[model samples]
Target: MNTPLLELQGLSVHYGSLRALGSIDLVVYPGELVTLLGSNGAGKSTTLRAISALVPAHGQILWRGGSLAGVPAHRLLKLGIGHCPEGRRVLSRQSVVENLMLGAYLRRDTAAIHTDLERCYGLFPRLAERRSQLAGALSGGEQQMLAIARALMGRPELLLLDEPDLGLAPKLVGEVMGALAQLHCEGLTLLLVEQNAEAVLEIADRGYVLEAGQLTLQGPAQELLANPSLRAAYLGG
Candidate 1:
C-alpha cells in the first residue's frame, strides 16, 4: 500500500483538566479529501490545531512515513503542510498580493513563487481583481477564498482546512466547496474539518465523526451519509 500523506496515531490533547481529544488515530492519503465531521465543542478545531503543531498535544504525527516530533509550526510550511485556519485569519492590513507573498516566506525559488502567485490569481480571480486592495475590505466569501489561496501559495502536499464554509450563505458554501474539489482534482491532499456535515460528505471520499473529542465513527462518505444516526443528527432528517 502507498504511504499516507499524513498520519496521527493515538493523539490526545488537554486543556487544563479538560481532555479535548482522547486517543485519536487518523490517516489521510495523498491527493485524497478526508472530512472530519462533528457538532459544536466536538474537538474538530482542536484536531486541526494538533496536527499543525499549533497546540501542545501527545501523539505521533507522521508525514510521509517520518516523525514530526519537535517540528515547529513555522517549519511545517516548508515541509509542505499548509494550514488555512478557522476564521479566515488573513493579514487584514496587507494587500491581497502582499498576504500571498507572506505564504511563501520560507520559499527561496523566486521564479516558482512568482509562477505560483499567478496560479493563485487564476484560481481566485476576485483576488486578482483586488490584488492591491487590503484583505479586510473583501467580502466574507472573498476573504475565505483569499485565505485558502494564500495557504496554497506555499505549495503544500497536504492542506489542513478548518471550517472553510463557516458563516457563508448556501450558494457561497457551494462555491467554496467547489474550489476545494478543484484543488483536490489538481493533486492536493486535504484534511477538512466541517460542521456542515451534509455538504462535507458530498465532497469527501471518506469521513470520521468526532464527538466530545473522541472519534465515534468513520467510514466511506456514501455509507456515512446514509447512516441513520448521522442523518438524524447532522443531515437534518
Candidate 2:
C-alpha cells in the first residue's frame, strides 16, 4: 500500500456543548477518490471543516507524515490543500476570471498562475466563455463548475469538496461527476463530502459513512453499494 497523503486519527470536534464529530480515523492516499456520505446534520461537512482548520477540532491531523497543528486555513492553501466549500461560495460580484485569480492569491509564480487559469478554462469552457461575467449571474450548475475550477487554480495535491452536486440538474450532476472522475484518473487525490450517496459511490474507490458526528461504516465502494440495509435506508432502494 502507498503512504497516505493525509491521515486523521481520533479526530473529534464540538460546537459549544454539541459534539459534532466523535473520534474518527481516516486515511486518504494519493491518486484516490474517497467519499464521505451521510444525510443532513451528519458530520460530513464538519469533517471537511476540521481538516481545513476552519473549526476547532481535537485529534491528530497529519499531512505527509507531519502534524498540522496551528496551521491556519490560509497556510493550508499554501501547503497544497484546496477546499471548495458547500453552496459554491463564489464571489458573486466578481467576474469569473477574477474569482479564479483570487484562488491563486498565495502563489508567487505568475507564469504558473496564468497556466493554471488556462487549464481551468480548458477544463470548463463555460467558465472561459463567461470570463467577464459576474459569478452571481451564472446558473447554479455553472456556478458549481466555477467553484471547482477556482479550487483547481490552487494546484492542490489534495482537494476537499463539499456537496459538489447540491441542487444541480441530473445532467449537470453527471457532468460534474464525470469531470471529477477525469481528475481522479489524472492522479488527483480527493476527499469528497456529499449527500448524493449513489452518485458518489459510482466514482469512489472507498467510502466512509458518517452519522451524527461519528463514522458508522466504511468499506470498498462496491461492497457499500451492495449492502441491502444501506440501499433500503440511505440509498433510496
Candidate 3:
C-alpha cells in the first residue's frame, strides 16, 4: 500500500543490435525480498545496471515515484540504492578496511560511516578477523561478504546484488546466503539475480524469471518453486 520503493515500466536496454532487455515492468515494494532468476545473458544484470544508470537505457525507471533519468550511478547511493556488481570485484590490492572506506566515498558524515563499518563487521564476523588482510587474500566466500559489506557502507535502503552466490562452494554459498537472509530480516530490501533457484527461492518472497532479455514469468517465490515447468527448466527436475 505504501509507495513502491522502485518501479520499472517498459524498461529496455540494447547493445548496438543486441537487445539486452525488452520492455519489462516490475515493482518492489518496501521491505520485500525479491529475486530475479535467469540463465546467463538473460538480461537480469542489465536490469540492475540500467536502474543504476550504468548503461544507456530507455523507458521509465522510477525511484519512489521520481524519474531516475539523468541520475548517474554514483548518485544512486544517496537515494538509498546500492549495487554489488557481478564478481567479487573487491579492490584486491587494498586492505579490507580500506576497501570498505571506498564504499562511502561520496559521503562526508564521518560518525555514521564509522558506525556502519562496525555494523558490517557484526554481520560478517570473519571480516572483522581479516580486517587488515588484502582483499585478494580472502577466499571466494569471504570476498563475497566483503562485497556486500562494502555496498552496505553506502547505507542503502534497497540492495541490488548480481550473483552474490556465484562460484562459491556449497558450504561457502550457505554462509553467504545465510548472511543475505539475515540482512533481509533486518529490513533491507533486496533485488537479487541468482542461478541457484532452489536456494534463492527459499528466502525470497517473490520472483521473476527472464529469458533472452525478456521477463517470461513472475509470481510468489513459493509458487515458482512448485511450478513443474520452472522446476524442469531451472530447478533441475
lDDT of 2 by residue, 107-139 (tens): 899999999899888888889999999999999
Per residue, candidate 3 scores C-alpha lDDT tens digits across 146-215 of 9999999988999999999899999988888898899999999999999999999999999999999889
**TM-score of each candidate structure, all chains considered together:** 0.97, 0.97, 0.97
Q: How do all the candidates rank in terms of lDDT, highest first?
A: 3, 2, 1
After aligning candidate 3 to the native by TM-score, how far in Å is the CA of 204 from where it should be? 0.6
- C-alpha RMSD of candidate 1: 1.0
User: Where does model 3 exceed 4 Å of error?
Assistant: none
> Considering summed lDDT, which 10 consecutive residues are worst modelled in model 3?
171-180
**How many clashing residue pairs are found in candidate 3?**
0
The per-residue C-alpha lDDT of model 2 at residue 48 equals 96
Given candidate 2, what's the lDDT at residue 56?
Answer: 95
| Between candidates 1 and 3, the lDDT winner | 3
Candidate-wise lDDT, in order? 0.93, 0.93, 0.94
